[model samples]
Target: MIALGVWQLQRKGEKEALLALYERNRAMSSLATYPELPPVPDELLFRKSSVVCLDPVRWDPRSGTDVKGRSGFRMIADCRTGAEGPGVLVDVGISDDFTPPAWTGGIVQGTVVPGPEQPTLVERLTGRAVAARPMLVADQPVAGLRQSAIPSGADVPNNHLAYAVQWFLFALAALTIYIFAVRRRLRQ
Candidate 1:
């Protein structure tokens, strides 16, 4: 039990360190300074960036929420680093109304993130899919929508601390029970 408690404490420390690293990366500046799309480093996830859209904007009916907690669908589209290059997926913003916006294509600034799976609950919500692997989250709000809330590592729940305390308590209880058993045996 004591060993288990120690292991949990170590895990707690590791989780805290990982969370700190994520925060550091998110706080870093945009990668948009690059003239061309550079190879995305793993540390660049959630990093802000700007890219030009090469295709028409598509709406992914996947339910999304704004920073204000307003529920809506995400506006996604294909973006390119250059006119002739391949494109990447970019989520522009959240739209409360179902109607598609008049946005054709242009330069957009936002954060980079992994693409979320299509929402399973609403089958009709699924629209034309883009081929971009890692998706970009636009920083600006869409014409008739609000800015999509960017995910933060701080949102990740780290329950390791609570788990460590539970393990320590169990260890203490076991030790006390053993002491009482020894005392009873000696009395007998």
Candidate 2:
């Protein structure tokens, strides 16, 4: 219980920091320069951009499901750049029923970067040589919408105080019961 209480307090602090960071990033102006991209650490995950095509290919086939729910294929496309520079990984969300063409065109709006195992999610799927797309490219999303993979869950759920109180109350009740039982035994 004590540990839970401490954890709850820590969670509160983290949630506050996350919200503050989000607000600050939301207020700042958007930039297209590479330097500007590195400085905005907070927006690095979701910063939007317009990218042209480099190559169209399949991505993330291992993470597939057959349940009666929404399904799609993960396709990768390199964002076109002015000079010979790094490309962003474009996650193309396709319906499970739909058959993706070998050469399709679209825009993606999420930062594609290297994971622990692979340079990009596409590489994780295809296992060929791949690099990460770290910027959010607004143009050329294969899914016809700007897709962002931000987690929508709340940062904090403050039920620890109540839980601590309940635990204390249970402890007190156990002690009272023990005392009452001893008194009754003595009287008998």
What TM-scores do the predictions have? 0.62, 0.44
lDDT of 1 by residue, 4-71 (tens): 77888899898888778778878898884423333444576667777777666355556789878888
Weakest lDDT window of 10 consecutive positions for candidate 2: 146-155
lDDT, residue 115, candidate 2: 27
Q: Which has the greatest lDDT?
A: 1
Which ten contiguous residues of candidate 1 have the minimum total lDDT? Answer: 32-41
Candidate 1, residue 167: the lDDT equals: 86
**For model 2, what is the alpha-carbon lDDT of residue 75?**
37
Candidate 1 has a TM-score of 0.62
Candidate 2, 154-186: lDDT as tens digits: 322445556656666666787899999999999
